[model samples]
Target: YNIHPSEKLIQAFRKKPYQGCCPIQAEFLFIGLDANYAYDIEEQKIFPKVIEYHKDAISFWKKYNVHHPFLLDGYKGDGRKYHKEFSKIRLTCEDSSRISFIELLHLPTTGRNNLRNTDLDKNHLKYIHQAIVSQYTKAVFISDAVFRLMKKTSTFSWMQDAREIEGYSLKVFHETSPLIYKHLHFSTYGKFQAQKEKEMKAIHMIISKI
Candidate 1:
């Protein structure tokens, strides 16, 4: 019932989280990223900066052992599988892999950010989101100045009006919007990300011109 990782893993995970323009879940930061032509300059504005890895949260992650999606909010296992196959990496206890897994799963975008009926299968999509998001992980790009400006924000009222927000975006952007809730329940991971990039590029292009 527990993932008793070696003390080495605990120490390894204690390392700090990267700070910068949180590309993931950073809805407003993208606006800044477009203005600077570089992520470095724009990421400073957002409050409660995103952490590279929630080290303390790691213990909670291990508490679940088998991933069931509801990681922090309520620990409710909805019966649908989360394919935490990726989490297995953290169990290795080797510093390299434990740290690497952090980069691999920046933050699971599927469950918390976007969710559909528990009836839907996400085993395949989880694998895809992990790969695309990890490519630009913070350990590689964030600077001390950036980290200095960032602080971890609390996850409060994050899902306040799920349907209204989800529906509005879906209505306006249709399938192209970056609203993961639109696709998490219906589209392929590649399609969702591709549209996300498109939306990002479109916004950046518009903002940079002004």
Candidate 2:
């Protein structure tokens, strides 16, 4: 991973041997984990909001007239659309109902009005990337620097902060030890793992009770 790759760097990351019983976006959509669980949104492999928005049922282009012009843009909803009963990953756990690729705690980044072009002082690559990585990401006004960096690095690898949780009842995705280990890039195995197992068992008991 250290080598400065040729033009094929992105293609390299995208190419992974996938043979699962379930449908994975990684095969064609370039959605799947290089690691166990995703550390960042890009690694999670969820559909890019704007990318999917342009292709969805809405077409502002055909609807737009000269004077009256409008277009519905990317991921606009209560987040229930992506909340599939069965996505490749598990954001919402085994409800047999609220299945999804990754359990989203916040809104997608595309919905908000981020830094404007006039607001160039704060339009930095790292800043923008950080702003959009949140589960409740309002919007990502990607700056030219961000784009250039990706192109230059030939990598979309960005910094990601694991979601924090207040408790350990599978109450949150990133906080649960087993779930995190299963679905996130972090690890839970070590001396403290015993406590995590106990907590997981306790949660299972709670689920059975409920």
lDDT of 1 by residue, 42-154 (tens): 13231111121234333433443432222233232221222232232233222222222212222122122222223222432243233224543222111122222221211
Scanning candidate 2 in windows of ten residues, the lowest lDDT window is 21-30
RMSD of candidate 2 to the true fold? 17.2
TM-score of each candidate structure, all chains considered together:
0.21, 0.21
What is the per-residue lDDT of model 2 for residues 17-121, given as tens digits with 9 covering 90 to 100?
211111121111112111121123332223343223223212312232110011123222322222221121221122222111210111122232232233221
The 0-to-1 C-alpha lDDT of every candidate, in the order given, reads: 0.25, 0.25
- Show pairs that collide, candidate 2: 37-183, 37-184, 37-185, 91-102, 91-103, 106-136, 107-136, 109-137, 109-139, 112-138
- List the pairs of residues colliding in candidate 1: 17-52, 18-52, 49-151
Per-candidate clashes, comma-separated: 3, 10
